[model samples]
Target chain A: MEFLLQLYADQTRWSTLPPDQAHAEMGAYAAYTQALHDAGVFVAGERLAPPSSAASVRVSADGKASVVDGPYPETKEQLGGYYVIDVADHDAAVSWAARCPGASHGTVEVRPIMAVPTAA
Target chain B: MNSRPAAYAVAERAARESYGKLLAYLAARSGNIDAAQDALADAFTSALERWPLDGVPRTPDAWLLVSARHRLFDRHRRDVRAERLHGALAAAARDAQRDFERAGEIGDERLAFMFACTAAAIAPEMRAPLMLQLVLGLDAARIASAFLIAPAAMSQRLVRAKRKIAAAGTPLPRVSPDDLSARIDAVLAAVYAAFSAGWSDPAGVDPRVSGLAVEALWLGRLVADIVPDDPETLGLLALMLHADARRAARRDSTGAYVPLAEQNTRLWNAAQIDEAESLLRRAARARRPGRFQLEAAIQSAYAEYRFGREPAWNAIVALYDGLLRIAGSPVVALNRAVAVGRLRGAPAGLLALDDVAVRSDLRDYQPYWAARADLLAATGARAEAYRAFERAAGLSVDPAVRGYLLGCARRLGTAQPSAPSSASEGKSPG
Candidate 1:
């Protein structure tokens, strides 16, 4: 099964950390990604730009499209990053997600990737 | 008739012990828990019909497994024929034959099934209901009654929870020990719920609920046996055992509901008490005392009263303080007042009672009124005590408890001797 672990945290938390601490955290994440790669379970993952860089696109009832600055209505924690990992089951995915450095002070919402049926 | 009842007793015992084990074993192997449970239920029904005549199988577990496997094979063949007909018949027959021959290789998988039922990925509220259904083989209605929910709602919740579990995939034997610990709290809560359902008098509506308490105890033992060093597991087992030990003493000779204070101490089950005490000691030695362990320690203090020792009011009050710190339920707070009254007089107990926030929270609560009446009567406030007793009696569901409360109201000014007590929330205290 493949699970998408969407990590979320306060956008300012990383920026407020001391330079050396942020750098150390980056190093830890690099090690974590490397570990996932070593285990051959990592499919794809990436960090996102802060919520300030995010743009929300909405379509009106009449199909008029409008772009808005920042997240849609904002939230306490912004989407920070995500990891897509192929593992045996949900628990394995949860174990892997728990090991992520961001999960120490953030949230990782694990959603199973919907399986698309192949052509017979 | 005698033989029939005896046969039923044997079947009941076997069902209590082997139902989960066999279902878990078959489900683990077959990978279709629903089908496995259906087949196992059919097997039990067949046993009810055939056991008395066949003189009960020498190995009921093996007999049930063999029957369930046949049922599974029949289900598989029916499904296969519905889809592909003769194309799959030969292969399916071979597979079924192989599975039947390999039945002896199946080991107990209930512990793993328990973890799966209480998996952290499942919603917290649904975990206990799921455990009751899948692990203990309780029907949705019985579980609903235990939880005071509509059976349909419980059934829907159970189906959703099962769907979630099935989607998660039962990763048999792959759960790490540390990961198992993370989910232990939910698992323990489920077991405790099972025990409580069994312990409570459900107005004699369902006798089967009573047997489930014993099964819950077995589950606690199984969990404790699996994780012997986990203090909470041991503590939970001790707590259940301690409560169960007083089952005999909970009623008078004429079968009236006797309060712990009024019951003859000699009626309490000594062996169960000893076992609970040892379990409590083990939990204490682990130095990881939690809510259940603290509660067990309080029960242990009450159990001391049976042996001619003064009911350890001081130790019980202290334990209640510790329990309040950890559990902090209003029920525990109310219970603590009884011990406080015993130790520091009725005025102090009433003061302690006042400190409990949200008095309106317990307006409909019978124990609160009962405790209030006890305290008032102790302080020689006959009129107030009588009113409180009337209120408690009005709210009480148990006829015996109602009679006891009413008796207190009738004996207003005479000042009857305050009986020795046990500190519990609703039911007869441990």
Candidate 2:
């Protein structure tokens, strides 16, 4: 089981976390993930670059695959990072999702991974 | 550099091993957010466990969706917050809330998912992968296999797609009666590809593939509702009806095997045949061409002659040519080769199919080899043909196909005596 914690912060709430404090909070997130890893439940995790560095693309009707530069549609909130935690079930995934600093600060989108078709 | 092919394959394998189904029991109660998400999470976890052992169940889409509903109900029982999430889904048969509405995004059901994936904010390369993941519930690794990339690259693409979809906040396209026709095109194309993976499964033993066809049909019906007058929409529905009408007849009563030309036409679906014929005629008269209408026309033509006259290989060939012009793909070319074989002999067809082997997507596809076996035999290369038949038999998930191919191989004097039916078959979408 894997839980994806989608982090976002309202401008006001985000700006209030001073740079130094924000760094400390991120450190806490790292520490929590390390705990998960040491316990052998952590699959993969990463902090995303700010939305400002994002890019987007779409295929037009004429069959053209096009690329553009931007944080895909502009929104006030931005995705900060993600945590993929391996656990027993939804309950376990939820417990792990809550451990992410984003849960306290922004919304976390937790999704379970799909099993693949074994080679015949 | 850190991602080795074997390791990448293993990582991809892990992703596929993890899907499970959740039951949101309280979905009938209220619009509880936590309950809903929890149910979704639970269902996904179940998807992971169930698929490997049981293979994907027939109602996987509904299974996951229902899991969410069940999970929500469980949550409702446990917490006051879930009452609404539980209620909304219960009452949602008619008055469902559109899940996501962003700028420039519209329509209901899976299309919303597709539009989000296709949203301008996401990269062009990200669109198909996103839809493959979210709507079809494929893992990044399986998706990576399709694109022939490392899991990391595929995972990165998905992440990039999600960020754009989230940021775009674009309004979902609201299809008016006027724009409905065009909208249906995009919707059908998306649904067609996904559903095809299900519908084309030779492994009829596994029922899970049924969801793929059912969902595609569901989406096609939705498209029909909006553009009821669109002949192409009608064609798609009619075509499916026509093909499905022969389901029982396609195989013998004992479920052994019966090819289309040998099947009794009296069992042919007259209603579906009628519907497809009408739709095809209408579309042809319109003089405007679309892929669905063309493909449907081809099927209708084939079905029409399947029982009565010699199969109309000429009309079928023409249809494939028209299809190639609209969507020129190697798979399309492979299909067209069959038609050419009918007209010019299997020898000519094999000459054309030589290029099919190198194409990556079709490498694992069993039919490609099966077709090659037939062509080789027809051209008098019986030994080589038996080998081809064996290769196809080795890869096929369908018991019936395996039986049929093995029978062919035996006839050619090359046979394998022991091969167990391992694991299960592909999901046979209805």
Candidate 3:
């Protein structure tokens, strides 16, 4: 099954670091991808920009449609970037998710992709 | 080393020894890497299926190699029996079997097989397949699966490659020490290609994919030893070794994603950093002037900065400047933009990014958006930053990375810092 492991961090925390510190920090991200790709375990990965570019929209109590440039939220945490992995089982998926650099501070939601049916 | 584990080890060693032997035979007989791998795989599967019952052949390798090679001929003859006269196929098989029967005799058949597979007559792309098949002696089943092609189709490519070489009179491309410079790049390129094939984890979703990096690095070192003074060759080796240094700490204790800045600095490898430092120094000192030298320097600087020290930023910037003069590719410019971000703060860095050519060649590379989005976010353009993050998220193949970018977008939507009237004045690049 394909599992999408989503991980995120606050952009503000990282965005304004001195360039040296920022470059140092991005090394971990590069290393992370390199580790997986080296092990032949990495399906795919990439780095992202910050959060202010987001737009959130939702239908309110009035039942009206609202559209925002970012994404709608569940409580405080929102949908960040994700990794789609074709692993053998849930245990492996969880193992991979736990390795994400942001796991200590943020949440990683692991969900299986739904099989679409085309029944007549 | 004498127990149940020992017994298991002994058995495993025996299997590998026999397997390698069978591969040697196949490589010799097939006249190319692909066909050799196919025949070797058939031998291996037959062993796996029959070993439990027959208790492993006394000369299991010879038995399997001869059996698998001849069995394939049997099938070919059976399929094309109507044109019995064209059994020149059988003639080659008979001749090969006779030669193989003499046994334990050698004339560098494996090396020649490799040369044929990596023959210049074949396209550049097929060289890795040939090496992975002939040099490493991996089976066709595994190699084919890794490349994500049908076995039959892969077999045809191998056969066609072999036939082309056989017809070309077996003029093996030689790289004597004097003329090694040009050929060394091609050789290194093949090694890089091998790792690239495995990097996507094409065959299975298992951790087995990482083995490709090991293979590539090993091959890189092998070629390096053959021609030691080649700087770019050493640079590729240093770069891979340095990149591979962080294998253990990439994930968290729970295996979730970990960004580099957030990763436990304690876990980064000192040994790898030292190795990279020495190698980068050696390559740079040689003054060979090549892309590998600059890229390795860039990465070496990155590895050093992992410790929170201001690295040789000026030297790295100089290296990128050299790269622009040499390759003039947008990717280099984009990377140079990061250095600009460091040397002259984010605004100047943004200007550098803006100045980079991104019309057709680099419109789709994810790193470009990632860099642009960083610039926008730094300057308080949150919405545009989010859009750039989204593009980066979609363009990359890595799951962890995509998830990370998406997280960045999510975090920005929920959190906002005080807007700086002048982002250029916010933080010094130093």
Candidate 4:
């Protein structure tokens, strides 16, 4: 099964960290991603840019689209990154999620990817 | 000739006994518990419809399996995923037929289904209810009542859990040996949770919650049968059996709560007690003591009272010490203190209780206050004891237990300090 692990954390904290501490944190995440690759379960992963640089788009029912600066309805824990991995089962996905560096101080939500049926 | 009532009885028996085995087999093959359950329900309906007219089948389980397989085939034929499921169902049906001819018993894939129910991906709170439904074939409403959840919400939760299991492709019968012990622990914890939920309602007054304890016992026996060599599995069964053996004596003729120490020994089930003792001995021979074993050993110490002997408080306290080292919680510490009070004087027990009183989790726990009240009254602190009794009664969920605690307080109010005595409390030494 395939799962998406969404890492949620305070996006602003990264800018205020000491250079050495920030480097160490980055190194921890690099090592975690490397471990996932070594385990042969890594599909794709990326650290998302800060929410301040992102935009939210909504299509109104009147066939008009509206765009908003920054994430809509800003929250304390912003979406920081995500990883899509293919594994044997949900338990395996959960184990991987626990090992993610973001899980130590943030939340790693594991969601199984829906399987789409193919027509013959 | 099979009358309608007799047919119904046979069908009910089959549903109760073979539901898990049949569902496990179907779900393992189909990889979708929701679909498998529907297929099994259809099979039962067909049985009810046909059995009365054609008489019961010679092998009811095999008959059900064959019928459910046909239902699965027919249901899949209309689906977009029919081709893949068709292949799997054909293979499953062949295996079922071969196994029936060879062993005359359905394949026992229940362990796999049980582990799947308690998989790490599932929410911790939902594991027990999911196990009750998937492994034991309990309805959502019955399980909802036992867990004190709304029926509709429980049904939704169960449906989502089943969907996740199927979507995640949790491998059946593929649990590695390295992960076996950990997975077994999760499964054991879920079963114990169900048993405790049921055990709390000793009076069994509510029709919805009444049969949960019995269903949990059946689940325990199924687990013990599957993993016979796992000492902790045997230990859990022994623990539940020890408590069950005292079920009848937990209440008096007037339906008042009777504490373990004051319960009438003659009303206890000797047969179940003997079985528990034997299982505990078997667990001891393995020399791998876990939390369940230690807890069972403590219960065994209390069972000595059934034979007209004083409970071995020393042994119980020592077992609690071991338990504290492993699975220390405020509840376990509170229970240990009660045993300490039994071994030493009320003052020593009070000191032990003080150590656990610092924990915030036990602030509203009824048993802790009840234990404190018992020790306070023993030491002749009438006012403090009365307040504690009232607090415990306020926290109690069971009316019988609350009434007993209030009665204790009332007695303390009317009696003289010179006549101070510790009244019995309910279900000590957890």
Model 1 Cα lDDT, one tens digit per residue, B147-207: 5444667788888887776677654445677776666777897787677652332111111
For model 1, the superposed segments whose C-alpha errors exceed 4 Å read A1-120, B1-7, B28-31, B52-58, B79-105, B121-126, B148-150, B198-211, B413-429
User: Could you give candidate 4's per-residue lDDT for residues A56-103 as a string of tens digits?
Assistant: 999999999999999977999999999999999765566567556676
Candidate 3, residue B396: the lDDT equals 37
The residue-by-residue lDDT of candidate 2 on B260-360, one tens digit each, is 55567787767767866776777677677777787777667667555566657788788888888987776667777766776688787787677655653
TM-scores for all candidates: the values are: 0.67, 0.51, 0.59, 0.70
| CAPRI classification of candidate 1 | incorrect
Give candidate 2's error at residue B197 in angstroms.
Answer: 2.5
RMSD, one per candidate, in order: 20.2, 22.3, 13.3, 16.6
For residues B1-430, could you state the per-residue lDDT of candidate 4 as single tens digits? Answer: 6567877766665565676887788688767677667767877767767766676678877888888777767766777576465566556666777888999988888889888888878897799999988876778988876775556778999999888788778447577778777789888888877877633321112112234666777788888988887888988899888877877876799977777777788998899889988999998899989999888888888888787897888888999999999988776787788889888978999999999887645644567777888889889999999877766654454556656666787678898533222232333322
Q: Give the range where candidate 2 chain B is weakest over 10 consecutive residues by summed lDDT.
A: B420-429
Q: Can you tell me which runs of candidate 3 are displaced by over 4 Å?
A: A1-120, B1-35, B44-125, B137-171, B197-211, B278-289, B357-360, B417-430
The true-versus-predicted C-alpha distance at residue B355 of model 2, in Å, is: 4.0
True contacts kept of each: 0.00, 0.00, 0.00, 0.00
DockQ of candidate model 3: 0.03
**2 against 3, candidate with superior lDDT:** 3
Candidate with best TM-score: 4
Task: Report how far off residue B254 is in candidate 2 (Å).
Answer: 2.9
